[model samples]
Target: MAEAELPDPPSQGIIGYLKMVGPGVILGSLAIGSGEWILFPALVVKYGPYLLWAALLSAIIQAVVAVESLKYTIYCGQPIHKAYQRLPPNPMTWAWIWTLLIIIPVVWPGWAMSSATALAALQLGRLPGPQDSYLVLAWGLFALTVGLLVIHVGRKIQRTLEIVSWPLLILLLATIIVGVAFSASPSAWATVLSGFAGFLRPRLGFPPRDQINWFIVSAAIAYIPAGFGFNLFMSSYARDKGWGMGSKIGYISGLIGGRKVELKTEEMPFNVDDPENLRRWRGWLKVARLDSYLFFSGLTMITLILTTVMTYSLLVPRGLAPTGFKVAAAQAKALSEVLGGLAWIIVLLGGFWVLFDNQWGLMDSVGRTVADNFWFASERIKRWAKNDPRRIYYLTVYLIYGVAVIIMVLSTVFKIARPYELAATGAVLGLFALMIAPILQLIVSNRILPKPLRPGIVSNIIMIIGAVFYGFLITAMCLQMFAGITI
Candidate 1:
């Protein structure tokens, strides 16, 4: 607390570089998995790629919100949770709403995915009929074990995330890039154009039996949550890194902190008075947002179009329904006439890579954020988990998540619920989460920000508008889901 000496911003040594890269790697992991990999594909198969725009739009909105989060962190040094507390606390009527806002949605994916994964493993070769019940038991066990490990060895948990994320991303991107290119036939191109139209020109009403239906049109709303889970998660990350806001019109962005993506809340905070450091951090901010580039944005938009085309071509019109190895088998069989199992490799690797890794990112970010939250707890408790406090806590979080996954997975065993239903519930939760993120960012950026480093006119305007747009999406989706609609 003395001017004479201050703990330096996180040491930028070899260790510092690794520490920084961790979050992005984690984010990368989560992005590919549950959201992009699993959810997007599932949506595409059912709806036939018309909602691809949803993905691009969601990513763009998320990037803007993410930058805002970084700005707050670099300036205010408060993670998103505390940042909300910085916002005026909610009235009694909204208290439970605010508390449940992040927690339920946040935990849903983990539980859902755990259940899915366990069920998946069974399909992949685990157990038999009434599969989900057995899976749920396993899911609960995994959550418990991971949680306990976190309570003991939190630091190991951190390293483990980095270990898991980077490789997953590299493998995933490589696979997808290849598969998408290879899959682009002239016929596929035609389908993409038409599907893009379908997505863009939505007919908002009831459809005939098994025609587009309410469930299908509801994609407009569902897409938001499908892509925006990390808005606030990353917001907390930015706050923790000590970022501040700015007029962002001319900032050409790129990836700065790949191997060096993070800074403890204080380390990255902006200091306008320190011109050199400010420039360095700003430069990194732009890079960290490579997905925001005009060209990249266009690519994402087109990707949406193409995905929809492919889905409708294969599914709705043809009446070809496939899942698991069956889906891959069909694709491979089609390609075998042209190039053999090469297509199979591309199908499996690319399709599965993103979803698998994305989980790592979500779990890792939350684990780290939680670790940072009460990292100062008595060493004795930490010792009980193990000597490595941070790792212990992260493992504990994963385990805490295991319970819900188990419950849902067991539904299959008990014949109480179905996979599609679980997917529907998860999709709804994810969408509502999108609606909640912007306001959280606004609070963190506005109030938590140092006055001098606050967001300027233009950026703030865009942010306010963004928040309202998502709020609208959230409201529509909630109404639809509550009313027993399914798309």
Candidate 2:
């Protein structure tokens, strides 16, 4: 591999490590929303934590994938999408397919609409009623608007994320811990521990007749923290934050009309053969790994276990499952039930922040992914948008707003499906990216990246395992859609 320019080594020390922690925190904050607050709890309440193994397994698999994907961005200062576009045979085609798979399913308006449901439930005694129809729409619209505005108000995207994510992440985790502590019993602890131990011997056990269809539901939940497109977007966040090689490419502007910039020659890839450069690269890798486990996987596992335990202790005994529009509200009420009205305030405040952040973070990621893909796929996009990241970024954001608003309006008017159900279904669809992302990330990491910079054999093996696991779920989902097989 020819030598290219490289960025300075990541800062070494407590402050330096702290600065590198934004992306994972942002991802963790988003993960705490629908999946933790609603789906995991609802499923555990009905299924008795029997499938806790899936959550444990999924987090490990995703962490492996996340590290490998970050390698691409850290090495080349480019997101995986651009690197995936360099794949053999038909890079553009592969990029197109994955881009669509990641963006479309995720934009299903489930999170925004679900936030509205919880807000309505808070204001009224139940989910949105006929008289509260306008208020519900306002709630959903408000979330979308705030999310869009937050990103636009600032010029540096990374700074904005750091300011918002860290505080919210801490608050969200504390609430879940407190909520679970107040609600748990010895038996509930037993169920959680047993299910976690079940990780050694995973099974699809007989599908539940009365509770959630764990077979399909767990697949969706697995995609929350690090699976689905969430893992892939981490590369962008890292690159934009100027970590390692990402510093070369710089970052996109957060404002809609921020000044335009172009990549400089020094920001390009560096020669792996250079010993000093290689040592610096290794240093940055350590930083990335630390952030991955500490904030990304660590917080994710903590929140998932607590929420499951809390709900298991509270709802499983009564055979109650939170469903439909009241999903978030139900979780809050569960805590309130055990610890009284104060718990409701705690849970509700935490739940609202999480749901709102989830929607906001996702919209930013989806917009960035699409905009980045288009920027790489065609010179026409570059010319049309004048190579300005802000223009393309806002264009995609507006596009997402349109799709989300349409789904929100239809779901409100028709009442065909509940908000939480719609959100979970969208998550299920998002598993499509998980199936393909590992393969693409693996290919790019090995083929496009220099040999010494490539992932180790162990990393490669796990990527395959991750692919196969998601493939099995995707196949099962396909079979159910076509052949009516349950499990």
Candidate 3:
């Protein structure tokens, strides 16, 4: 090939590095879910980031599991966007029959908007007969505004995400800054250090007064099913960039080989290819590592660390959101007692984008990919979904969201509210099972993928330990829940 024909030198250098980091970051950032960033930070403000150990431990275990899932999709030809299709379920379709439950995340906007009422409530504080009502009204208005923006300014799929992440990233940073600046105290660091200690030993539920309930933890774990989407998203982004493997993968970054010269230098988060990795690893370890530190230690670990810090810095004291707040208002009182509400506010924004968009965007894409890969569909249908795919998951997510909110509201109002039912009803269990599956897949990937692509001995140990620790923790949580101490 001519010199011009040769691929650009991957726009390497510091700026190029961030570009590579984008895709993995999208998924890795998933580690900052509503639970950790929002609820956890809220917990921290209320308790102090000292419980960061719980957040850290949870994030570390889950990140290990999440990266492995994404790795299977990226290097292996497993399109995780619709991994549910391949998971050995059959003889019956849980999705078709359980469509009601599937829609929880879809209609999530209402819940988000309801939660977002904080902006207005804080502004209007102690000003009205019913502040929460005004908050809900504000949520309705916010959703409409976001919808209009998505409809008008976001002319294309990619454009919309750009719009979303711009605010999401900005706000995510704001949380860490504001919470630390405001919430920190003489006891803060000491508490945080002690909190980190909890990372090693995860107690199932919140401290006694929080009354978090067993169902809440279940809800957090339920998203494990959603982890599959990240794998598919990162894999496609990896393929788009070209270096799905090597130091690039290890760094947990994807290289976008042919973008504009100026754009190339923006953020090359990728780890360049390395022969050394191929020499030392094989199977799942190799496949999971993709790009030296990029995919594994570096990319995944950054997310885990950020999660731990964010969790400690925010969640432990904040009280864990609506449920936590209920406990506080009924049991405690005073917002000052809750920490980092603003940090949590930012986290909620990020969570909404990461989880919702990832699901909606990838659902359509995954459905079409699977159809082409396994089924014999009409060329037109295949082309449409493949080129501009959309699927049932989006609608399901949207609708179920509406139901979940209604249920939550009713439960809260009627005093018959077993809102934990949303999670107990199933999703979290699926998420946990899914987490276990990746560790299994990692072992399998090691055996299945080419010898050169395997994970390192260290990676394998880390993953194995993750699997064991999470497994044991879940068991304890279950036992604790059953023991009736009231989480």
Candidate 4:
């Protein structure tokens, strides 16, 4: 691997940094998927706002995890997975482990199935029923096809996500704001505000032992901003968007317009010992931190709170809890009480986009993660693809699409599990990866980067806390699932 001289960071004030923000915006949009649109609302409707503190905790911890992971990418201009390949006794071991870890949780297609139900409800002018399984399946396939077309036509995958995400993000937030303004009562607002402090609420701090559904709760936590291995993809986006040392490396281009672009597999390390390089490194780090806090953290928290409050206000009063494929439909039905028939259109349309965007973003990340790992892990694959990462990426994308289609058919036709159920199951299964990712990030950043470029004490402590917290949750969930015990 050749070492590249560190270029001076883009000279910019706060305004310049704000204008440069793209990856976090895309990430924030991705974060708003099944968790916000489906899972969080379901949790709120069932337990009221008492569980909201978990959302708060998740956001803060995941923010630390995301920023620390980016340290490797910003310093090396490669996805963090590339750094993971440098870990331990055998590089191939982590590569194969992470590929499986990324694929298993994301292959469920829950978001697409749920989005299809929303579309089906929109077409039918009512909540979809069991009889509508085929209808929903058709819509699910349609959604996946459309998502494929959009990604294929784009010049760059990250650029496409940014362009689509910005408007979708604005629309989702605007829709939620309008719904909350018209529908949420003053008392509902108070309850939601206090729920952020739910840890302090006596006997209500955590779900009671009997009411605890470990899988669903784990899913909810996983999705507080984004869940499972998805947050780790933030480094990939930042790299593709040319943040920090990523400016020197190439990105994964799309199939049509991006056919000629080649992703550099060679590691490009900056000269961290240079004073100028260190100075530029600080500036770049600042940009990443601001982007994560403002777009990823800020947008996610705002959306989560507003959506939860609005759903709690609307559904709890009607004794409704969204579950199954009816997740979006149930919310639309509740909104109909106040917004009239248009409520169905409003709720379902917003829900579809929320979920569709999630599906689109998640598929891309999963494709990228898998392709990168395989490309790095196997010289045979590298030779087979002829060194073009895009070939592997697109192939992975289409293959995942095929698998998702199959899963959607089975789930819809045979009633294997509800959309939310599938989402929760996928999330819970990914918890081990989630638990290990931060610890790996901590090791990679501390061990590889120069002292001045290493994570500070606070970051180290926060990452440790995040790892331990997730490890504890994973243990409790395993005990409950296997030992017939609850904690």
Which prediction has the highest TM-score against the true structure? Answer: 4
List lDDT for all candidates, in order: 0.46, 0.73, 0.39, 0.81
TM-score of structure candidate 2: 0.93
Kindly provide the TM-score of model 1 when superposed on the true structure, using C-alpha atoms: 0.68
TM-score to true structure, per model: 0.68, 0.93, 0.60, 0.95
- Each prediction's Cα RMSD? 7.8, 2.5, 8.9, 1.8
Please give the distance, in angstroms, between residue 385's alpha carbon in candidate 3 and its true position after superposition.
Answer: 5.8
Point out where model 4 deviates above 4 Å. 202-204, 324-327
lDDT of 2: 0.73
Full candidate order by lDDT, most accurate first:
4, 2, 1, 3
Residue range 1-487, candidate 4, lDDT tens digits:
6666766665688778866688889889988878887787787777768878878877877787778777778888888888888877666787779878878888898888888888888888887778888998899899888887777756678888899999999999888888778778899889888888888876546678898877777787778788776778888888888887787778888887776566777678888777888888888888778778778877898988888888888878888886654656776777788888888788888888788888878788888888888877888888898888888888988888999888888887789976777778777877888788879878987997778778788888877887887887788888899999998
Q: Write the per-residue lDDT of candidate 3 for residues 74-164, one digit (tens) a residue.
A: 4433333223433445312422322222232333332233333334434443211243554544453454344333322322233333345
The local distance difference test score of model 1 is 0.46
lDDT tens per residue, model 2, 308-408: 77777777676577664354566567667667777766666666776888887887887778777777776777788887766777887888888888888
Residue 276, candidate 3: alpha-carbon lDDT: 37
Q: In candidate 4, what residue range of length 10 has the lowest lDDT sum?
A: 322-331
